[model samples]
Target chain A: MKSDIILAGVGGQGILSIATALGEAALADNLLIKQAETHGMSQRGGAVYSHMRISDRPISSDLIPGGAADLILSVEPMESLRYLPYLSETGYLVTNITPFVNIPNYPDIEKVMEEIRKLPRFIAIDADAIAKEVGSSRASNMVMLGAASPFIDIEFSKIEAGIRTIFGRKGEEVVNLNLEALRRGRQFAEENR
Target chain B: MQKHLFLGVEAIGQGAIDGGMSGVYSYPGTPSTEITEFIQENPLAEERNIHRTWTANEKTALETALGMSYAGKRAMSCMKHVGLNVAADVFVNAAMTGVNGGLIVTVADDPSMHSSQNEQDSRFYGKFAMVPVLEPSSQQEAYDMARDGFALSEQTKVPVMLRITTRLAHSRAGVARKEVLPENQLSLPADPRQFILLPAIARRKYKGLLESQNLFLKLSEESIYNRYEEGAEKSLGIIACGIAYNYLMEHYPNGTCPYPVVKISQYPLPENYINRLDQECDEILVLEEGAPMVEEMLKGFFAKGTPIKGRLDGTLPRDGELNPDLIAKALGKQMFSGYAIPEVVANRPPALCMGCGHQDAYVAMNEVLADYSKGRVFSDIGCYTLGALPPYETIFSCVDMGASITMAKGAADAGLIPAVAMIGDSTFAHSGITGLLDAVNEKSSITVVISDNESISMTGGQDSSAFGKIESICIGLGVDPAHIHTIVPLKKNHEEMVRLFREEFAYNGVSVIIPRRECIQRASSRKRNKK
Candidate 1:
């Protein structure tokens, strides 16, 4: 009945889409949700994060305190490790293996993956490849969200419905493609975990 | 009633609309831009034809809102914390002028400087102006306070400030709507010379403002936003202000703090509740978002009161924001922390977009400036400020809005010949004009680079007031027309841009080189909108 998630990625990487989908699903279930987002200057391709908390009871803080996050769901591999301090000891870290190499001094991809592999419970997914397999590479964020879905408290069907509601305006083809991307990602996580 | 999910800014917008706001004025800044944007896009606001448009700057925005209030229509003006500094003259005087109709001044403060230069608290401004300030602890309260803030303003015949920090402003939560109230009919102030600040009349108005302190305090004491709750423990009394209350409650998830708590969202310190807490507890802890205003006041100049502790006393860090862990640590509660970040994780600072016009402009400027000694370029607030960072590093200063031109002028006056001022089009419109006029009159030896991206480009591409009129404005301000050159900022035009920059930098008198291009982000979004 409670979930504290950290959505992390480089700005413009579409992590907010995952937040929107989760927020819609949480609200549909009549759960109290608080999501704190990064806006303004940081949106210009900087490290960005959104702290999302959903509970059956009234939520107190917009922020998920350090080490209280149930899941660190990141769309980028290196960006996932950036929020390790917020992840609970037994929490899940579901992150995309693709690196967003905007900075000149980005660490080696293998080193970043090594850090992620050190986590007690984590799913290192090739979300981009999965989304491409489902039809659109742009749906990578959806894939990452799906990979994290197993750890979230919400039901899978509700998440699908949430996606339908959010992407309803974008037409059925786009919605169905994203759903497939989500399903493929979930399948990968289920098999890998 | 079904709850509508809303960001804190959106809640305020909806609240203002439902509370029958006739007009909403603002200049875009982070954490505060969405309030006006929400009103701009709302169906009801459109149907009612309420005033919602970007102003040139915060000062003009507040003044326009004040004009609407002068006509007895509920009005709101919103801005980020620094914007208040630009509008402070009118803000303070408005307290003296009072209001004919309800006026709410909503200010969003960025505590961690997420998108700001400083973290100065706006509560001090409210206290200085001696007006009521409502700092909501939640999105629900954000809605309710903005809805009822106008009433508070009207009751006291002064402006009410609805203040929020960046966290509350950007955070999303469910907010239920209230029944929509009708906008007030237009009417004039009862006193004919009320707004006229001619010394004799101003003195009397100032006296009335001073006398209203008691009424303001009484209202604060009676405010629904300010409350005192009894607890089992009295060893330490805690005063949680605004969003800090939420962080405090986060520690006690069951909603029970052992210490007696005074939750303050309404201003003037809510003295009565504090006095009660002071009498009962051995020591007091003050929790606030920004500056330790309450803590300092309680401790006083002599620092001999109730063993008060906060930022000043190091119960909390002196700078940055207050998070739940910080609060828990202060309370001596068990803390939770996970693994440290790997050493290989490098910093990824915000950068100009890959195909951004500012990038091309900076490339040209940096190439031209390579010949000259470093530390000559003065920049203003905008996305171009990122030029101060790696890859380009063309700009030397990223001071306040429009400080580029004036600072360049000062440096030139101090004999740093050919001083360069790099400013954005929107910022040039904001406050650069006055400084440009001064430079023109003095014929200062400075090269002004008006990087015209044709939008604010920062704070998410709000329309720039100088969109198509930059050249005309510069010319009208008495800059020599021939010396003002325009070049398209693109890969193809790099040589021309470099030539223009070199030409202007060598000019003995004031010269302006405009690198014109639409922000790629704005251009793409426009394309999407068209599609």
Candidate 2:
């Protein structure tokens, strides 16, 4: 009845879009949802996060308490590790393997992957490569959502519908590319599992 | 019956619309920016011909809303906590003048200094002005408070302060909308001189304001927003205000807290509920988003009454925002198994965009300023503030909106030759022009770089009030035309920009440099929209 998710990534990386897709999916299921997003200065290519709490009952807090998040779905690998404290012991973490190398001192990629791999319940995928293969590089976030989709409580079909609903304005071609990206990501997660 | 998923800011806009607001005025600032943006974008608002426009500054926005209210139309003015300081003169005086139509002055406070200069609470402002402050716990309450805030304003004939912090303002939830109320018809105040606070008349009005406190308190006690809920335990009474109530409620998911609780949204501090909680409980913890206003008041100078716990007593953090984890810690609940953050993650402080004009301008300034002492460059708010970080840490101080120009003037007067101030176009329009005038009059040896991005790029590209008028405004303010130089911030123009900077730095009197370029984000978005 309740799913507390932490969406993490660098700003302008479509993390909010992922939150919105999941939120719309939750709404489609008649679930109450509260998504607390970072706005203002943080949006200018800074490390950002959004706390999403969905429930059958009225959600009390906009934030997910530390160590209570059921899922930490991130679009960037380093950003994923940034919120490890919020992840429940039994929670799942699905993060894109690619590093958003904005900072001069970004950690070694292998080390970042090593830290993520240490977690029991985690899936690290090359979302960027998969998204490019799916015919749109911008759908990397969709690939991330697809990878996190199974761990999330919402139905895959519902999430797909949510994507279509969100991307419908951009034209059918864009929608299809994102759909393909999502399916590939879901397939990768399923195969690995 | 209609429910729409809305951010807390959007909910306020929706509530204002449903509450029959005729005008919504504001100057764009973080957290508070989206409220006016939402109203401007609403189709219903357009149909109603609502007066929704970005003002020159928060003061103008407040005054414009007051003017609309004077015409007997419900009006709302919104701004961030700092913006309230800009509009404080009008806000304090408006309390004395009272209202003809309803007026709601909504302010969004950013705790933890997120996108703000300071985290000063606006509840203090409401308390100082002796006006009722309404803080909503949820998006629903945010909607309801904004909808009903008008009636509260009209009934009391005083502007209501609908105060919300950044979390509530930016947080998203489903808001169930109410039936639309009709806007008030145009009518004047009963007394012609009601707004005129002449010395003799001001004393009478001040007395009326002071006397109105009892009525405000009575209303607060009677308000549904302020509730005293009985519970089985008396070990620890909880006093949660606004969004803090939501954090408290998170602990007791079944809609019940074990301790006696006072959920405060409407303030004058419903004394009846406080008295009951004081009598019933052993210890009381006050959980408010901002300052420990109520906690301090209850635990006075003598430190009398129940052991009050909150920010002051290390029960919660004295600074920054309140979170569920902090709330749980206060309640002696289970703690999170704190995972050590990897040292690998470098701090990703916000920076100028890759193609941002500010980047090029900063690059040029840094190169030019190498000949001079560092820390002489003063900056103001906007995306340009990012220049304080990496590659080009050129700016020394960014105190407030207009402090840069004036501070540069002061430093120049103190013999910091060729003192420089870097401000954005919107910020220049906000408060920099006056300082520029003062520099002109004093003939201060300062170089003012008005980085014209042609938009208020910091708060998500709201229309810049100084869009195309920065040059004219500078000239009109008495700066010599020849001294006002313009340059495009680009790689090819880097040499020219540096040359201009060097020339201005050597100028004896006031010299204005405008680095002109549309914000890349705005430019791209505008292009996409056109396509």
Candidate 3:
């Protein structure tokens, strides 16, 4: 009845969009949700993460305790490994294979992937490529969310409806493309499993 | 009523709207920006014609809100913790002057210095000003306290402070709504000389404030926000304040704690419950965000009789922030050691955008200053403050708002010739004017680079107060017209920009070089919206 997720990415990468979609789904399911987000200077290009907790009962802390996160859903590979200290032993790390190369000392992508693969449970996807294939490269965050969807406590239908609600202003074409991207991401995760 | 998700800032804004706020005044700052933004965007607020607009700075915002309150209307002024320092002059005096209608001065503290220069607790300001401070532990309370805070102010004839930390301000949760109230009609203070702080009147008002301390304590004692919950164990009593209360609860999931607890959201320490906990329990653990204000009061200078623990005693780390894991460790519970992150994940500090004028401006400044030794550039708070970061670490000082020019002037006075001051346009408008005026009065030999990005940029591109007026502002401040130069900060104009800096540096008097360009983020977004 409870899910704790750490949504990670570079600032302005639209990780908040994925968090909002899940929040909307949690609301539809009548679950108590608390999401702690980073704002201001960090959004200029720093590494950022949102600690999201959803439960059938009231949640206490806005922050999830370290090692209690059931999922580390990251849109960037290196950013995903940054939050390993918060991931539970059985937690699933769903991250994009792409690297957000804003920092000068960003390590080799292969080593980054190797560290991620060391985790007992993880799903790495080229969410950017899948998003482009589904139309709209910006929807990669949605694809990252979809890859983590199976582990989320909320139903997939609720997430779909949530996306419709969130992207309603962007027009039907954008929403349809995002839904298709979500499906493709979910399919990839399912096939890999 | 249907429940809706809202960030703590948005919830406070919504609550203020429903609570009959006549005006909400602010200058945008991180975590605190969205409060005024929410009100400005709300249909209800617009329909009510509430005075919601970006102010020149936090001081102006506080004064404007006070003016609204003087006319007997409910008003709220908001700013980040450091912004409170900017408005401290009026803020302290307002407590002595008291109120005519209702006023809520909300200050959002940034622990961990998320987007600020320090992690100062605003509660200290409340204590210094001797006003009641309401610290909400939850988003719902963030709404409720803001809604009820106005009434508390009206009843006490003093402004009330609703303090929130970055986590609570930026976090999202479900907040219930209240019925809308009507704004107060125009009514001046009962006393004709209530607000007049002449030497004789100031003494009387200060005395009144000192006497009112008892009533303030009484209000805290009876406040619904402060509670005493009894537990079977008396070995360790916990006093959890503000958001720290939630972190304590995270450890005890069954809605019960083994230790007796006092949950404090209202200030003045709720002495009665503290006494009860002290009498019943052998020791006390004081859990509070920011500085160990409560813990210090309880511990006192002598180290006291009963053992009290917190930041000072290292029960909690003296700095940064508190999370649930730290709370668990404090309770002697076995802590979880999650997997360590590999060194591959390097630190990704915040930087100026790719096309940001600040970046190009720094590039040109760096090139121009290559001949001179480093540690000559002083900068203020803004995106340009990032010039202190790598690839273009050009700035030498990142102090308070507007300190750049004044500090540079001081350095020039100390024989550091060709001194440079870097500041953003919004920051220049905020407090940079007076400093520039000071430099001009003395004709100090310092070069001031007003990096005009045409937006606040730091706190998400709020409209700059001196958008198109920077040149005139400098002229009016007595800078020579010939010495005030403007350059477009782009790669194509790098040489021109460098030449401008060189000219200003050699001027032997107060000079300004305004590197003007619209913020790339706002520019691109505007283009997208136009399409």
Each candidate's fnat, in order? 0.90, 0.82, 0.90
The DockQ figures for the candidates are 0.91, 0.83, 0.89
Deviation in Å, model 2, residue A12 alpha carbon: 0.8
Candidate 3, residues A93-118: lDDT per residue as tens digits? Answer: 99999888988798999999999998
Q: lDDT of candidate 2? A: 0.92
Off by over 4 Å in 1: none
lDDT score, residue B351, model 3?
Answer: 90
Docking class of 1: high
Tens-place lDDT per residue, model 3, B1-531, is 688699999999998998899999898887799999999999999999998989999999998888888889999999999999999999999998998889999999998998989999999999999999999999999999888899999988899999999999999999889888887888887798998999899999999999988999999999999999989999999999999999999988898998999999998779999999999999999999999999888886777678998888887899999999888888988867678989878999999888888888898888889989889999999988888878898998998999999999999999999899999999999999999999999999999999998998888778988989999999998999999989888899999988888777888999999889999998988898799
Of the two candidates 2 and 3, the one with more favorable lDDT, higher being better, is: 2
Fraction of true A-B contacts recovered by candidate 3 = 0.90
Backbone steric clashes in candidate 1, count: 0
lDDT of each residue in B1-531, candidate 1, tens digit only: 899889999999999999999999999988899999999999999999999989999999999999999999999999999999999999999999999889999999999899999999999999999999999999999999888888889999999999999999999999999999899999999999989999999999999999999998998898899999998899999999999999999988899999999999998878899999999999999999999999888997876668998899888999898899999989998877978999989998899998988899888888988999989999999999999988888888987989999999999999898899999999999999999999999999999999898888888878998888989998999999999998888999999888888888988999999988899999999999999
What overall lDDT, based on C-alpha atoms, would model 1 receive against the true structure? 0.93
Better candidate by DockQ, 2 or 3: 3
DockQ of 3: 0.89
Off by over 4 Å in 2: none
Pairs of residues at least 3 apart in sequence or in different chains that clash in candidate 1: none
After superposition on all CA atoms, what RMSD does each candidate show versus the true structure?
A: 0.8, 1.0, 1.0
Q: Which stretches of candidate 3 lie over 4 Å from their true place?
A: none
